[model samples]
Target: MKLCFQNDNICVYSLKDWVKLRKEYRIIGEYLGSSQATPTLPIKLLPEEAIFLINKNVAKLIQYPKLLVEPTDDCFKEYNKLQVDLQQAEQKIYKEYRKKELKPYIDKIVIAKQRKLNDSVSTSSVLNEELNRMKVTQENIIWPTLTEPLDCVKGESIEVPKSILMKRTTPTKILVFTDLWEKGYYVTCGKKFGGDFLVYAGDPIAFHAIHIIRCIEDPLKPLHTSELVAFGRLGTSVKKKSVLATKTNETVNYITINWLDL
Candidate 1:
């Protein structure tokens, strides 16, 4: 089972799990790690989203009951030793690889230098010294590592009960979201669109949002005319339908609001 970690909040730390969730399940969660403007993983799942995944048996939520133990003095020493070892290993591999790549170039350079010396005042000792110096200069060249940080670190899964997951989000919001999701629409948080969710017919990136969905927990609750007009006008401006989603018993209902110029 794919495991999502629950720290301060529920999040999918693994890039593989996140890709599957978005591509397969159409669960597009917010990327909330380093560089929000230019987002990188791990992505954060909304409470409703987390609960939906749990209910569907798509993923298991794991909660760390206690904070990770702080590193001991010995641990720091071991880590520094490991870093030094890694640097040494990298340097050795880099030298071998670079030597092979730069061999032809170095040969060309050495030949040119020898030809220049031959034209001027060439001696066997002087030529040998020049070649040795060139080789040493080439060997001293340092290149940066191409390695990237690991996507996620695997840890022991501490299974959080389904009942506990249920407590994280409101039932009405889940019901509305699940209904839309089951209908094959891609849904993402619609705060920017001034709604609870932005519903797209296909991949959110490829298609324009079809609906700006606002979840209404109480179907019978009264909404002000101004609020309705604002939603409708905003939706029209963005070329999307404003939809109010609510649940009556177990059935979810959608009401579309259209703004008219008249």
Candidate 2:
């Protein structure tokens, strides 16, 4: 037997004995008093309401009188189950609304930023040199090399010298491509599987270089106005900066990558 809070306001009983009340009474309002009665306030009961309340309360007490005496493990378990069920229902409702209402706005902002990047004139160095003070040797940089090269539709690859590779022990490569920027797409690296390498062509090199320098300058505060503007230029809006800022407290160690390795 269980007590259920139904439709946010009414309480329902699920015992064989309690089920007889439904057959004995017609409308809950006739037995319980005004089906529209608010749950928080006191109810003005007629004779029928008083009789129904006394009978139900007495029956519940008789059946589960121990529950009225003290809190029990079974009672706690039931309470926890109800709480979990309520939370699950709420999360489902929120997720549905977020996908339908919020996602389209985010996509629109991203598209607008991409258009801005496409329209702007290219700059050799968008990031200031002072910001690039942190340097790592090729030997120090980490390179996740590719097992097989992806078929390149455009641009030619140049040989990366071993001398450049030996300069830093851990080399991290940022891949940039002109076509992605020209088409108004934000370039993101693929997942770091074993033996994956970075590659970039034309303007993407400049963007990737700026991103690396930014990562070095204040790795924690990676999303500065300049970075936001860069993203905006590429077609993404900056609304999520505040949310990201909250997460920036988590520590991230620097990993260096040489341009040649990509």
Candidate 3:
């Protein structure tokens, strides 16, 4: 798998590898592409995710030079031409379909219009002309689904660098994630829930997250009362249990906090 380092995140550019990682390995990386379109190639992995994959020998970390290049005038022209050609081809096919499918409806419309006008206009000609000049609405246009796999970039493999290490995901966080993942739970970033990781009983798509995990790096450290209350409230509001996971030299421990309202 091509693990390209881009903008402090490890990215997988190959669609095949991304699908395999997500479906088989349960490594659900965030898709950084357009939200309007179905997710395609190029998914950015969190720091913890990249580290886990690297440690497990699932993917190698690499520094790829020339990751982005400026397109030339010819490239822009070719792209524009391709877009136009696709539009034309789709329009042509849809026009034929509309002519056939909408024939009865259009004929009825033409006949009614002629009757209202009390004229001898041919409905066939009118229907033909209307269908020929019909404009395809945005809803009628179908966007192509991109399922093709792209060529993976082979960059120079290097040891995990300091720059890739994020302050948000500490060693303890990784340990917590690894522990939960090894125990048959699907773990994902929990920034949305104001936690370190969200743990699911099974595949995330099939089951709702069961716990919002926050890792305490120091086993002896205690969370402030307000912080603990807030974390518990957040989990309650999101319909999940709040869990504080702390790691000692030998093992990791988890404590679930339940917020009760009187």
Candidate 4:
């Protein structure tokens, strides 16, 4: 990612490295500020004066980072403070401008302003109603679901509740198979397929059964295997022309087990 600073100089760094540096340096202003150049100061100002000027400009640059991207706590806090300052400054500027440029023009125009103030409403009841409305709004807000669908497939056996699976309108079953003869079976399977089948398939029989079922059913369905496990199914103990095994250091190499060994 290219990080451009206030001086208009850009530095290229990996996203991870940039995040680390941003946290370490607390350079939220540099990241969020507008690309447009600011009015140049004619002479070198005192340190305090320079800081004040920079702070004002810094407020203008304050923006929240992408929600998907994680920023440090300090960066978030600084960004929030700068945002608040920017809003206040904007309001103040607008108020001054309106007073100077708009108030006189409005004053010259004849206007009949009728303010209809409600007298029947009690202040305490209004406050309570507003508070209740705010509470209801907060309660109704749906927070984002944190869990990723792919996360259910990546590493370790995931024991999904039968009840939950049954509740789905179209429940999908993922079956993973591995050859015991293959070296790094669990790692390879998990890396490729991910999920419960990789971890739970302890013996050749279980693995063969799962694979046989998958080979028969997978082609009939819309479901597809991950890129890592696209080599189709494998069998156990069966030695057919389709099956081949090479041994190196007592570990099995790319062995193609027959699909019919179900």
Candidate 5:
């Protein structure tokens, strides 16, 4: 598809292309007006969005978002077959949805965030030990692989390069995000929260974010006290811890600071 980069977000003006982006790659964005008066098509891409497409080879960067396209069947077969059953205890599976989700690590338990629990299945207290360990509370988890519904994945999965993606963002930022994913914690971009990431200890719908982390690539970079003060205040105001993280070879190191009353 062809999306022009504008105002830090990619813009697509064609209906066919827009549908392909939405239905195939599942790039979610805000839709502008199609009225006769406001005959403009604008879809806002959040920071790293266009690049996410680029790194996945889904979209290219001619400046920001200019990619080569290969006509692939948008069929939902491969993604449909992704759910696996444990041989010892076979159970059902589901793909659920929420806005702006990525499968990220394939081996991890896929959690559908910010959406209502599926009516089809309730959380079963007595599940196989392995299933309980994976933390899939219930079924109905649909993939956003191809369509709007959660748990849906692309029929032809996009091969994203970590090196390509990390280049667009800071090492520390990716470090914290990947680390959280690996550690079984949920994280979302904290653009609105005045931080890099909002750290959720558990399912976002069930629990609120416990921390707001700002990433610093260079560990030696001096942090401004005023900046820390502001972040600490904001985190406390929202009842979340304010954290600063730095990237290293081993893992991301985190430091939390609280605002002092004195």
Candidate 6:
């Protein structure tokens, strides 16, 4: 299978190829459709995703033409414009909320203004300061993405996703991810569930995360009993196993904590 690298993700140009890849290799992404003759299948993938596929030789990278096609001046400019527009819109919303928040003061100010006094000036001053602070935060919030992979980053023979590593994914997390992947488990980020990963025994479409694993470099090390209790409760509530996995010399040990809710 071949994947065209672009927009910090890989694209399988044809729908047929996308279906084949997903059904066979479990490659998942957005099924973006276009109004043109053929629908565009744009798949969003993480840096490790592409790297893992390439490393396993299950898929091929088609990042040719040293100059990337997207993420040009126009793309970034458009994205920034969208961000600004969204910020301004949200600002209007919060401005309404702020008015409601200051309703009592606003009523007092309305009476003061009617009486031709400057008592409301201080309130206006504080409100304006807060609004200005909000505006400042909304400016220059850059979204890190691309329309296609650029030629600047590549290894000796293939494209390397340095951004993923730079994002500081710990070696332990990566090790656990690859280990589960090799064993036919579909692993995804489980930070929301207070675990390193959400492990699915089968395709996510067919099954939910059957286990939530918190990766530990050393299991013998002491951990808070409260943490274990919380993790176990969460897993039990979700009908999944709460596990602590420790790796040693490429071998992982799983210690399952079952909540005996008697």
Query: Could you tally the backbone clashes for each prediction?
Result: 0, 31, 0, 0, 21, 5
Compared with the true structure, the alpha-carbon lDDT of candidate 5 equals: 0.55
Each model's RMSD to truth, in Å?
Answer: 8.1, 35.1, 4.1, 23.4, 19.0, 11.1
Q: Relative to the true structure, how large is the alpha-carbon lDDT of every model?
A: 0.73, 0.30, 0.75, 0.30, 0.55, 0.66
Residues 123-187 of candidate 2 have per-residue lDDT tens digits of 21222221233333333322222222222211232322223322321222211122222334332
| Candidates, ranked, lDDT | 3, 1, 6, 5, 2, 4
lDDT of 1 at 165: 62
Q: How do the candidates rank by TM-score, highest first?
A: 3, 1, 6, 5, 2, 4
Choose the strongest candidate by lDDT: 3
Show where candidate 5 strays beyond 4 Å. 1-164
Model 3 TM-score, all chains together: 0.76
Model 1 misplacement above 4 A: 34-37, 65-154
| Candidate closer to the true structure by TM-score (higher is better), 2 or 4 | 2
Which is the better candidate, 1 or 4, if ranked by lDDT?
1
Q: In angstroms, give how far residue 141 of model 5 lies from its true place.
A: 28
Tell me which residue pairs clash in candidate 1: none
Query: What TM-scores do the predictions have?
Result: 0.66, 0.23, 0.76, 0.20, 0.43, 0.52
Tens-digit lDDT track of model 5 for 1-262: 5445434444555566666755565444555434333333456543344554564676653222213343245434543344433311233331222111223432232223113343232223212322444433225332122212123221222333335444557756755765775676766667788987777777565778898988887888787889888998998898889998887785889999887787
Candidate 1: global Cα-lDDT?
A: 0.73
Q: Give Cα distance to truth, residue 8, candidate 1, Å.
A: 3.5
For model 1, residues 11-120, the per-residue Cα lDDT tens digits are 77566777788888999888666532456676777777887887888887775533345657877797567666666665566556666665556656566777876753
Q: Model 4, stretches more than 4 Å misplaced?
A: 1-70, 109-262
lDDT of 6: 0.66
TM-score of 6: 0.52
| Candidate maximizing TM-score | 3
- lDDT by residue for model 3 (1-262), tens: 6577756767776778877887877888777654245655567787888778877888876764433446578776986676677768877887788778876687687777789989867877776777678564444544554333222324334554634655636888878778887887888888899988888888877999999998888878766899999999999998999999898885899999999999
